[model samples]
Every structure is written in C-alpha cells, then in structure tokens.
Target: MVGRKILDDKHGGKKHLYALNVQYARSEFLKRDDQVLAIRLQQEERLNARKKAAVDIDRARAQAGQDGEPYAEPDPDLDEDVPMDDIAGDNFGSKTIVIHVGSQNLRLGLATDALPKTVPMVIAKKAQRSEADDSEPRPKRIKLDDHAPSEEWFGDEFAKEYIAMAQDFKVSRRANKRRVLPNSRELVTKWNSTTPPETIPEHSDPLRIDWTELPANEKAAPDYIVGAAALRIPERSRPRYHLYWPVRHGWLNEKDYAGRNMLERDFFLILEDSIKHELGLTHRREWSQYSCVFVIPDLYEKVMVGMVLQEFLRDFGFQRVCFIQESLAATFGAGFGIACIVDIGAQKTSISCVEDGMIMEESRINMKYGGYDVTETFVKMMLFDRFHYADFNLMRRHDFLLAEELKGGFTTMSDENISVQMYDFHLRAHGQNTRKYTFKIYDEGVLAPMGYFRPAIFDHSDKLSGRHHLIPRSTDLYNGHPNDPLSKAQMAVISYVNQAIPSAVTAPSAQPVRPLATPVAPTPTKNRPLGIPSHLNGDNDPTPRSSPAASPPPDDGGTPHPTGDDLNGDEIGELKGAQPDTEIIDRTVPVMPLEQAILTSIHHASGMDERKRRDLLGSIMLIGGASKTPYLGQYLEMKLRAALPQYPKEILVAPPPRELDPAVLVWKGGSVFGKLRMTNDSWISPLEYDRLGSRILHYKCIWHW
Candidate 1:
C-alpha cells in the first residue's frame, strides 16, 4: 500500500497512468478523439509489402515441403492440452482436493470423497540433548503462582493453574462489559475454588513412564512424530522431543526456538507429512494430478495465504488452488442464505456473519480461548476435590490427552445437572503396562463447561504472572507497532537505506545520491497526490501539481515513454517513510463474550442489505468443535435473546441441515463449493500466481479477504 501511494504521487494521480494499465484508459478515450482512432486504425496496415513481385523466384514454393506448409512446424505457441477457458483450471471436479486447515486439525480429501481425513495440526521434533542436561526453555512451562500465602487470593491465580493444563496455548479472553440483569454475571466472590490450580502436581517419577518394560529397539525415537500419532506417543518418550503446533489457536504458532522464519517450514512440514502419509500421495508427481481447494480463516493474514498458495501450487506440485473462508463455506454446506457462524475450534474460537456466500469482513473475529479452555477448566475443577490420579501433569502428553478425552466424554452444559458419578479408565502407554483406575466426579463436569459463560473463573491475565513474557502474544504481518519485529518488506527498506547512512553522516558529497541508497526525505507538498501527512490527510486535500500531456500507451511488447515525475528525474530520495497500517481493524484484539460477539456481528452487517439483518440475526449457526457441546447453543440463545429483546419471539440457533455434523460442516461446504460450476473461474494455477503474485487472491478468492 505504501509503495503504491509513493508511485501514484510521482505519476499522474491515477493508477490508470501505469505503463501496464494505461492502454485501457487510452482505448476509452479513443472514441473521444476520432482523428486518433482513425490514425490508430490506419497505422494497423500490413507490415510486409502487399503481393511480392514475380522476380522473387519460387522462394515460397521452395520453402514448402511436399506436405503443404511443412506441417506448420507444430505451432510452438499452442497452449497445453488442458482447457484454458474452463474455470477449474487444468483439473476436473473429481480430481479436485478440498483441504480444510483448522487450528487443531487438518482435513483433506478429494472433493468427490465422502469424508475428509482429520489429522492433528501438531508435530513433535526430535530434541537435541546437551551435555549439561539443561532444561529446554518452554516459555510455556507452568510455574507456581506468585501470590503469597498472606496476600488475598486472585482468580487469575486459579485461571493460571487451569490454563497451565494446556501450556502450549495462552488464553486471553475478553469478557463483554455490557450491561446485564442484576446479578446475572458469574463472579468468584470468596475464592470458593477449594484448591487453586497454582502449583504443578507432584509428578509420579517426573513423568510416570514405568521405563523398566521397554525393549532396546523401541528406545530409539524417530526424527519426528506427526498428527494423531504425535499425541499418542509413549508418555515417557515425549520429553525427548520438542512439540510444535503450527497453526495453534487459529494463528501461525510462533516459537522462540524455531524463530519466526521457521513458521512456514513447520507449517509446510505438517501439511507435507499429512499429504504424504495420510493421503498416500507419496510421490510429488502424483500431486500434479490433483487441484486443491484450501479453506482459510475468515480473519487471515495475506502473507499466510501467500505462503499456503506457494506451498500447494509451487512447492507441493498441485495443479491449481482456491481459498474459501470458513464462515462462507459453512453457509454453503448448510444451504443458508444468511447466518451468523460461530466456529469454536480446539484452542481458538471465531464468529462471523455470512450473507449469501460471502463472509462480512467487519463482522468476523478470532478469539484465543476455545473448547480446549473448557478441557483445562474441567481438569482444574476435578483437582479441587480430594481425587485419585493426583499426579496429573499436563506437561506430559498422556495427562494432556486424558484431559482432552475427559472433556469430550463428560463435560456438558445442560441445565439438568447430574450428581457426582463414578467413572473408570485405563491409562495405556506404548511398551508399558496398562493400569486401570476408578474416580468419582461431582458437578465439576457441568460447572467446568459453564466457564465459557463465566470468564472470571479461568480468563484472567493481570495476576497470571509470566503469561505475557513467557508465552508472548504471537505476532504476524499485522500488529504494526515498533515492539513487533519488521517483516521482509520493512527490513529490505531499512537495509537499502542503511547503505547510504554513512555517506549522509559524512560531508555533503558532490555526487548525487539515489532513492533509498541515500537517506533523505524529499519534503512533500500538500498539493501533491499522496503527499499529505496521514494525520492531516482528512483536513488537507491532495491535488496533483501538474497534468502533463498524454503520451502513447505501452505497446504489446510493453515499451513505454516515462512520465515527467518518474524516478528517472535528477532528484529522487527517500528515508523510511510511514508504511500503511491496518490498525483500525481490530481482529480478535479482545476475546469478546459469545453473546456480545453475536450482537456486534449482527449490528455490523455492512456487506448484507439492511433488510437481511433480521434473518441473519435469527438464523445463527454454531459450528466447530466447541459448538458440539450440549446446551451451549441453548445458553447462547438465552444470552442473545436477552441482548436482542426486540428480535422475533426467539433467537433461533439452527443446526446443520439434514442432520449434518456441525464440526465438519465447513469442510462439507468447501466440497459443495468445489462442485459448483461458477467456482471454475476461481481456481488459481501456478502460472497465474507467478504473473499476478499474491494479489491474485483479490480476483480469485470468493470473499473480500
């Protein structure tokens, strides 16, 4: 955006003046000037002399073989056998692959397949051991709460211990401060939690491996354990590897050890392995036969999308690629014209308003906490009562997995609460003895899930010490503050400017300096296009200083006469100028309450017509893993009805049509979208990507993203 503005100020105020685009403007003005059109038409005369003289000899006949025209030399410029006019690019619908990349899972299969295979979006890399046996710095590791015994207890301390169960992700939920009925909000008044989840439980031999039973051959761990297999690895073997969750909590998971650059590498590795082993596309050549439809989040980074496109079409050998937003695809899957989609993934939750087939950009949000939080809360609640399996440590893979299984099997949100019940389970480890144990759970099963409605129970940050510094908030291309590191584009500009900093520091040179090679701000004029300071742009209008005479547009060979204000001029210098920042759009900046989020999304229906707001409000669909929780939709409906009292008699929470599973609804929508005839024009082949760059998404993606 910054570079485009800089070029516009240097040229005529319009992008229509660019050498590549000027011809279209020229053609439009052709009719206005009949003389020019006539001259242009006349100039299109035959290049070769009309009808060669007889003296030329039988040159044409001599060149031609016995076969007329010598077989036309096979027409070297002919296109590939693939149909260029068809929108699906080089592949057909049956060969098309639909990949739904979720925070916790990766789903991929052919569009024609009945179901997509779900793989965990996690990997465990072999760790390099050191001589000293220093502990690997897991900034995510849990530590005892800092609150002293004499000091008054804090809910954040309880929340801290609760979140420590799934230490990989940091939960920062923003509860709505919206006005509610008297005493409606759930609050922890007296630190009623009998046991604060502060200190890590005393581990049974640090990990409870029972290593005596393992054989020698099984001791050697592989280089990597990926997907579901990674989580199910021997509990004792986990400490030897460093876990990496690529797309954690719906954003690229940034790790201090791998650094930011390796994010794409990890992402590519996860997908690459999943495709290689899970789909049985072992050879890269096989990928060429399939086209891919990639599902991206409603709120996504442009760079992330670019990375995915590059991986699929450029690196992975896919013939073509297309991106569809999760919310938009959900509607397609459900056959809904307009609805609010709340996707509650494992570690992240997103809500968006989709109308027809497009997701409204302003109405989309991605929150950090999700169904996984409920799992953690459930574990914390269980620990409060005197219970067995007290050695539970989430840092261990077995314990973490058990917690997830517990959440899925027991946690519920129904109003009819069941009394404490007895339960039994067998804990099995690879090459180890299986142990059976029995435990009784009280209302914790139901109360823990209710934590989603009560943020005070487990969504605290201020008192949860080391959360920010330990597990720092993940950064991407956005979050444009100086504290955040510069991206490749920003770093390139700085490096270019640094080259001339030495010259500027020395005496004024007799030699002229070029643009970024010399650090200098060419004083901008208010009247110049794009020259007004951002702060003053609203008050001050930009007017081009001069309009030069129009020149001939670029020819088919792409040659053009430079405009007067082009960089070819004698004076052209620039220091690091202000880059355009998309700070105004608050994307998951706060983890808004579910009801408030729904209300806000309904109110901010800029994409849909005003008349459709009512239908959009009533026909809300809650999908994703968390949405499957019993009574969640009911509770959400209750909250929404309270907030939107004026809406119809009830706030309808529609389930997927024909009993379709809510969790897989988005993937099914993508499959349906893949089968559409109109979607043919939306796939981007690698050739188009090379020519148009990441900007191709603007033309190809169905949604505004």
Candidate 2:
C-alpha cells in the first residue's frame, strides 16, 4: 500500500516520472459518467509503455552483441595505464568565466585565473538636473565645535538622566546589569572636541580627484561611479548623485516597492559595468568569447534567476551560462563532499546542507540578518553609554562607514576577559578631512557580536517601533510567464470513477487482498498505446500542448454522483471543489540564533538518512564575513554538541580550508567548479536558452532544483 517513486538524480530529472494512476486510489463503490473512456485510455498508455520498454531492451541487446568485449582476451597488464591526449570530461573550457555577486561585493574572473578580482557591490549614478540642482557638501559633524556648551547626551530628558546616573552609579561588573555602561576612565576618544581639517597631499592620492569635495574647478561630475569610489562620494554631493545596493537580504531589493523595470535595469547595469571595469572586458565582442558560471544563492527566487539569465544570454552576449548554488560551490571550493555550509553576508544569513554536491531542499534557510545587523547593534550599544557622536545615523554615508570600520576592527567573539580601556580610530569620512575621535567601550565590543546569538538586542534598535520589511514581491514569473495553465475543461483528467455500484452494499467490511498477477484478455487496440488520447494517436501528430491541470470530478462519496436522489430534507451540502491558493513569498526576518538555525536546518533535511545526518553534524562548515568573528566556529561547535548529546561523531566547525577568508570561499568554489570536466555538458548556451526559455534550467541543472 505504501510505495515511493524517487526521481532519478543523474540526469537532473530530465526523464519524467509519471504520477501514480489516481484510479488505483479511488473507492470502488462510487461511479462517474466517463469512467469507461478513462479506463480504456489508461490501459492503452500502460500497453504502449510496455512496448517501448521491450523495444529499448532489444536495441540494447543488439548493440551489446555487435560491440562485444573491449579486449580479445584477458591480459596480465590490465593494471597498466592507457595514455590519452584529451579527456571528454575535462574542464568546461578555457574561456569559462566565474561570477559571484553578493550584497556587499562581486567576485569575477576567468576559471584559469588563480584569484578572482573582488569589487564592491555598489553603484552611484549622477542625478538628472531636475534632481541634482542646489546640492552642497555635508558640514563638519565630528563633535561639538565649542567645548562644554550643550548637554552631554543627545536623547530625551529621561534618557539623559538614566545615562548620567548609570555612569556614576558604580554598578558592579559581576552583576552584569541590564543598564550596561562604561566606566569614567581617562577618555581616549575625545568628547566635546571637534576635529581639525587636514589637507590631502599629492602623490598619495590614488584617484587624485579630491573625493572629499568634488573638483573645485570642474563644472560637473561623471555620469557614474561604482565600487569603493561610490561610497567616497560625500553627503553634500549626494543631491547630485544617488547610490543603489541592488541586492539586500539575499534577493532583489524591493521588487514591489521599486518597479520591475528599475530592478531589471539596476541589476543588469551594475553587473555589466562592474565586470567591464574590473575585468577590462568592456565590449560586447569581448564578452561573447567567454562562458559564464554564475554562482547564485542557495535559497533564491526562481524568477530572479530567470531574469538574471535572460539578461546574460539574451542581452549581455555571453557565449554560454550555467548556475550553481552557493552552498554546493562553497563545498567544491573547500574540497568537502558532505557538510553544512553557513553563509553570513552583509545583510543575510543562509544555511544549507550539501551532501555529495546536492543541496537538500529542506535544509535551506535564508534569514534576513547578518554583518550589517551587528554593526547596527554596535551603534545602539555605543549610544547607550553617551557616545561622543550621539547624533549618528546609518542613512548618512560617512556615519555608516565609521560604524562599519568600528565593527570590523573592534567587535570580537572571544571571551578572554578583555580589560576595559579607551581606544580611538581615525575617521576618514567621504569628502571630509581626516578626523580622530575617541571613546571608551567596556563589554560593548564583545556583546555587540553576541547579538548574533541573542537577536533581542535588535528589537529596540530601529525606532520604527517594530521590525522593518526589506524586499517586496510584486511579480514572479518563474515559469516563463504568469498566464494561467490550460483551462481545466481542456485538461480534463482521465476519469477514475467506477460505472458499476452494488446498490445494497453494507456500510463497511474488511476488504479481501487482491492477487498481484490478475491477467486480462488481449484488447483490439494493441498497436495504440494505453493512455494515448484519440487526438494524439495519429502517425504525424504535430500539435503542441501546454502544461496541464486536471478538472476535478464531482463528488463521488458522502453522496454518490450517479445516485443524485434528493435526500429527505436532511443533507444540504457536500465537499467538492477546493478553493484556489493565494500567492506566497519566501521571506522571514531573523529571530533564531546561528546555532539553532544550523542545527534545525540539518535536522530538517528531507530524505537524508541517519548516517548522512550524522556526517553533516560532524562536518558543519561556517563561511561568511560575520562567521569570521574570532573563535566563533569553536563557539558554534560547542553549542551544537551541547544540544545533541547522543550524536557519536565529534561535531566540528571548520572555517574555509587553509584559513581562507569565508567571504570569498564560495566564489573560489565557483572558479574551481567551472574548471571541472563533469560540468561541460551542463553549460546552457544562447541557442538552448532561446529555444527553451527558462524551462531549460529544469533539464540542464546538475541537481533537481
């Protein structure tokens, strides 16, 4: 009664696995109008299938017999090597290009290259005259220009009182009270003192364009500036320019809020411009010579992928294109056959378990929180202890860079009882003269990164008073177009209802077990395959059909369809047609800790046996910039082991092999993957894409996506 039909994975499920016959699962008591026609069709399909199988067998036998054995006789030198010049399953080709575009950066290079060129994933475009007029650079905001003039804090009256009390209250360190404050040690970071402007020296300036303030002599700025330079464009110059981060929280940012046309343009332009500028492949002719290996996130929208590929093959003039999941690529890059890969990027954290290069669907968890969140946590924690620059805001470009620098330099995961001390870093803000600011932070440096395990810290960071939404879904065209499938009437299902019914059958009875081999007499339509529709039975049936959905049959139980006798004023309604489903999107804000997320993802992997699960537990691999916090891998391993005591294998969390930065591991894997011989047949060329459209992905992808 129980059976499973697993799709063959070798061919990426190109071989269709027909669904089980619904008639076999239906009750024999009820009857429908078209049962006879459906039964005949089903039988015809079965017979045709058998004939095809027999013919295939015969052809295989004839071919095998003609070919015979490779050697005429057994030889003692069987172990000797047979030299070959060219292997078919070698590198995809020398012209292969690997591109990995993340929210924060883009890695691109030829497969043969040793290291991929990294570029910041940001773009700045000059604003039109209507939008750019009357712009000015940001005024100095390091600290109070005149010392000891205004109140020391930047919040409300109650907040000021609480902070003043906490600073002098001498709260015990051991208590670790909720009101965490820094001690009144000698201030390394100056308060109430403003930064003195410093002049830029010649020969040291790389761009030599004076990024702090736009060219004093030039009439206008360039049309576009991307990568690190984009961030260097100061606030005063922003009215003349705008910056867009095309990707956020692991997807196209604000598809619903931002028009589809805008998203499409932003994504295409950013990638093309970045590639051209970084790789020095500026012309369409240059692009056409190379095939592209695009590394996509493990959990991604199919529509997004299709849109990206459509641009690459149809517009970008690439010779060929293929996509690989980030998790699988990371595995290849790390030389791991089975492991759980955790990626924490600037704005998203994704976890997936890859076993033998196949990413398990159940273990794919993409949460909307990552390194940026930690930066935000740092700002909030600093402001609590009377931060010198209390008017800080991330929306301001310079402020964000300052906070990011702090998070990168000071934030850590180690618990070695660091002594409380004052530290300072020079703030080289965009368009602003180099300035130095000082401040003292005790537990904040460590506790800020700890927010990864305790997301509650973020609950109060944003003053929206609640969680803010990142991206929205207005359109999803994963299957070519959004047009509805063939109407149910045209796609009527093969009827399964029995025409005959026993009128006086008892309410219920134990059913007898039927024999397996119940033979039936030969039918007249032997040549015509079972399940072939009359319209499609001709020798030259050229008419094409669209994808189908079956029409639901009228109720067959509760009250049989054929015996539609009016009940004696007792029955009024029946369950028949089901309501159609509503549109759904895959997105969730981060609330769970890294440890819980990894463990839950591994445990939820569908179809994974116990042995594989154990192997995954033991080989959990941590990647992403946030995961690089010192000693974070060991911390995660300890937490996972504590949760699963019965597990025999020692749970280990390994960073990228050879101590490579987790940030570039996935891109490295893509470079490695593009060179593999097995991927030769996987490349989807422009011709194939044009012929099949997005549907070609289902047939060519290495795994059953």
Candidate 3:
C-alpha cells in the first residue's frame, strides 16, 4: 500500500490522497502461504479489532465515571476548534503567526500550527514574459497635468489617472530617503524617524525616487484628459516611481471580506520598501497594491531566493522560518522506515542519514549523479546510435532540434513547438538505401529521476548534441572513480533493473543457491532417498543403475540436469525443501530489520560491545534522501530479523505523517522533544554551542525524543 500510493503519485497527480493502513491491512492475510487461510485469518483479525475497539471505548467511559456520555467536559478548550484546525485551533490571538516561501510555481504555506505546507500559486494569473520587440510602432504622445508631459513617462494610463478618477484611491510616496512607501504604522514611524532632511546625493543612488514637479491645471479635466496631459512632464534625473494603493475587497461589506488580499497588499508594500531602501538599483519604477499585499514589480528578470521567502512570509504572516532539506522531507513523507532522507532531485541526488528523526553528520552521502547525467547519457547514445543509422546527413538538423525541444520541455524556456530536420545520408549519399530519416524528441531515448527512482525515456533535446572542442574527464564512461564497483553496479545492473522491472526485483537464481565452493563429492549420510542402502546390490562397485535405453552423454557438452533420485526428492514434499519454494519472503521484513537488529545487538552484546553502543547513546536518528526508497523497509526488516533471530520480531519503522513534508519528521520530532513542558530541563541552542562549544551539545540517551 505504501508503494502503491508513491507509485501512483510518481505517474499522476490524482492518486496522492489514497491512504492505506498498511500494517493493519497486511496482518489479515496469511503469511504468503494459503489464500483461503489468509482470508479466514483476515476476517478473524477484523472482528477481533472491532471487538477490541468497542472494549476500549467502554473501558474509557467507565474510567471517566461517565459510562454513556461521549464527552464530559463542556469547557471551550475541550471543544475541537473547527475554524483553527489548520492553524492550531484558531483562537486568532495576536501571537498567532504563519510563515511561507515558494518558487515561481508553488507558494509555500505556513501557520502557527505544527509545521508549514507548501501550496502552489502562480505569481501572475495567465501572464508570461516575452522578448522585447524593438520594431513595434511608437505610441502617440500625451500629457498628464499641464506641467507634466506624456513623452517622458511611459506606463499604464490607469496608474496616472486612478487618484483623480476614484475618490477612494490613495497615493503614498516614500516618506524618507527609503524608496518604499510605508505599509503599517510601525513602518511609517521607521520611515519618518530615518529620513534625512537634506538629500544625501551620494548615498541615495539606488534609493532615489525623483519626481517631476507637477503644476496645477487651469481647469477641471476629464479622466481621459489626464492621459494627454502627461506629455509635458520632464524625466527626473533619477527614475520616477509611485506606490499606488487600491483597496477593493475590504471596502465592500466587512462580513464578505476574505482578509487574504488585504494581508498580501500590506506585507508586499512593507517588503518592497525595505528592499528598495536597503538594496537600491531601480529601473522599472511602478508597483501596484491590492489591499495590503504587494505584487511583484516588473523588470526583475530573475527571481531571487530571499524575495521568494519574503513574499511567502508576507502572504502567510508567519514569524519564524526554518529550512529543511527537500529530500529529507520527501523521504519521511513517503513512509520510509529509516529516518534517513534520500532525495534524487532534478540536478543532484543527495543522501543524509538521520537517527531518531535527526540527520546525522557522519552518515551523510551524496553524489553528482542525478537526472542531468541520465539526460546527457541519453543524448550521447542517440547521436552515436541514431545518426549512425541515418549516415549523418541530418546531423546538424538533429543536434539543433533535440537541444531546443529538451530545453523547452524541462527548463520552460520556449513555448513554441520544436521541429528537427534529418537527412538519410545512408540513402542519399551513394543511393545505397531508399528510406527517409527523421528525429523527434519523444523518440530520443533517455532516463530521468522520478521521485526517489529513475525512469528511462528519450532525452528529447537537440541542444546537448554535437562534440565540444574542450573534452573534459567525462569520456571515461564513469564520471569519477572509474574502477569503483558501486559505479559499475549502478550503470550495469541496478539502473538497468529499475528501468526494466519497476516496483520490485526478483532474485535471479531459481535454485536455493549459496556460494558453491570447488566441486566436492557428497558424503553418504544415514538420511537417504527412500532409505535405500548404498551397497544393496553387493560388491560395492561405484557404478550401478545405467539404463540401456538412455542416450550416451555427449562429449564437450554443457552440464546435465540431475534426476529426482540424485536430488533426494523422495525425502522432500512438492511444496517444500526447494529453491523457489524454500523461501517466499515477507518483503517488508527485509529493509528496516537492520536498525532494530543493530540496536538489539548492542543491547544484548558482551561488555565491550555494550560499551561501544554507549558512544551512540545520544539522539540516534535516520537521515538521508535515499532512505525513502520503497524497498528499504523490507531490506532493513530482513537484516534485523537475521541479526536478532532469537528475539521477538516486532520492531517497527516510523510511519509517515498525514500532512507536512516527511523530511521534517525528525526535525519536528526534535522540536517536540525540546518544547515539552518540563519542570527543569536544559535545552540546547546555537548560542549555547557558541558559548560552550560542541561539549554543550552532547547529552545522554535520556535526552533523545
């Protein structure tokens, strides 16, 4: 069931919410032996669970001294806060805060609740950037006020006329040398207090917002007339700008207001002002505000990481911001038993081992190997294989089209569809062949990382083709450590198997095979096939039962299959004592069994070994992006089972949480650990580390969550 939901999400978006109580669902079936027995067991288990639950409810009611009542307390705190469920039951106190951050596509969600959830929000509704066209016709000149001319100012006319057109419109300028207008009373105070009476020309280069003096109009002009009046305004020595505030939602019925729009407007203005005042460098000068939220201003070509964070925090009004590795979040989210988070992202694959939900330093492992490498490999394969078949006539065309197509699809660079030209050089050069040749993105074979795994497909890009003049070290096949066994395994077997057979891998050998040493004759034992004596016929001659009808064994041929008598089949049943039938493993027991086995080994070992376990006494957690591999739990389960063969096999892996990023589980667990209402306890902080060094951070096992 865990694998099912994960696999579904990997393929499509619709299956994400399908929840299966894996442990409960799994217990009903017989342990991979008989379906009928499993069905009976399943029914019995369900009935038992229902009976237990009913008993538990009855016991709870009796213990509470209210045998029939569902609940006893009538206090407000006892009631579940329906409205505030998303943010710790929404008493809406002044202390309630939320923080969020996002990229161009996803707007992260944050609140005063447990942890934050990242929600996707497009920055603009159906808006996109295009290359500026220089050949377009120039607009006719217009003027704003009689003193200001239109030719000097170029922007939306609505921006200039909004104040005059609507009585509700309010215009605010940067109060001090700060280039941003105030959003709240506190910011306004900061602005007024920080302003210098005299303009400091040298310090205000990026912060300056020079405005052209506007003269009073002789007569009242129509709203459209302001468009023409702008023609006379002279361009200021520095870029001219305005902060326009337009309140739309809050102005309507107070009961109908969502409050989100106002919050965004208020926070955007505050952030914009801070950035402008501190960073400076202004070119595109106009910004619009709807209530309190500020919209991203025009002309900032690339999105900055800090700005993204700022926007999210403003939108959500969260106080604190914490950064957790994405892979860790995903790994934990996927229900990988180990706390380690393994993330194979678009650019790289990172691994960090966590213990007790905290990432451990020593166990962290990462590699540059990721989706990009796969794509490059795909490109090389295509050029060598595809172009060779075509005989190189369409070589140049193939290269261009492949690069453009791939870039467009993955990088979101171009919106237009790509077409490639291919020539059948094999056919046209000497008329040796007659078939035409063509190349397409969909047909170019490649592999890319999907979630924690990789799926092979076409590279779909022409840009990566063609030989580079400066050939670096990548030609050796392996990126680094050419002789590395793991590298070989990844390329030849693991990657191959993953692409060919997804979800699970079956072991190859059909026989119950172990590492066989040099051939040895079997010793005669008392346990014999049908209990027949070896020397039954007499003289003890080695050769006995050769059939006359059987064909003679061929010389220089492969090994022959053993007969039922030779295999000792008479002593074994059909369903048991054979390779495939010898073991039908419970998959979940293999991966995570090692953790408990290791822990149990430490617990039960002799004095020296027990002392060794003491070194890891404080805060053991699983970390690493790859720890979320679906089969990891099963793998560990087997190892643990083997390690602690004599102990009860009840060790369980951490279950994934219902909401928030899974990677944050360890961190959240750590947070929960630190924040417990204790009588007197020492909580470690970064400052304490600075003061007392690493010695302060160390603690005993009791400190662990």
Best by TM-score: 2
Ranking by TM-score: 2, 1, 3
Number of clashes in model 2?
12
Reference-based lDDT, residue 137, model 3:
14
Candidate 2: how large is its RMSD? 18.9
lDDT string for model 3 (635-664, tens) is 444444454454333433332546444333
Candidate 1 least-lDDT 10 residues: 537-546
What is the per-residue lDDT of model 2 for residues 471-495, given as tens digits with 9 covering 90 to 100?
2221223222112211111111101
TM-score of 3: 0.25
Candidate 1 lDDT tens digits, 1-705: 111222455556745332344445456553543344223322232111112212222454565754467533222211222222232133355777788987778888777667788998878766653211233221121442434321112234554543453221111111333222222111221222232232223353245444322235545656777787767655445345566777756666652234555667777888888888877888888889888888887766555676688778888888878888888889888888888888888777777887766766556666556887677667656544433444555556666777777888887765354444567665645554455556666456766766555443554231122112212322322222212212221221112222322211122224332221222333443442222112111111111111112111222122111111121112221122332121211111234456655655554453234456667767888898778887888878877777666664646876787888887888988887776532255777777678766656655666543
TM-score quality measure for candidate 2: 0.63
Taken over the whole model, the C-alpha lDDT of each candidate is: 0.54, 0.57, 0.27
Q: CA lDDT of 582 in candidate 1? A: 15
RMSD for each model, in Å, please?
Answer: 16.0, 18.9, 32.2
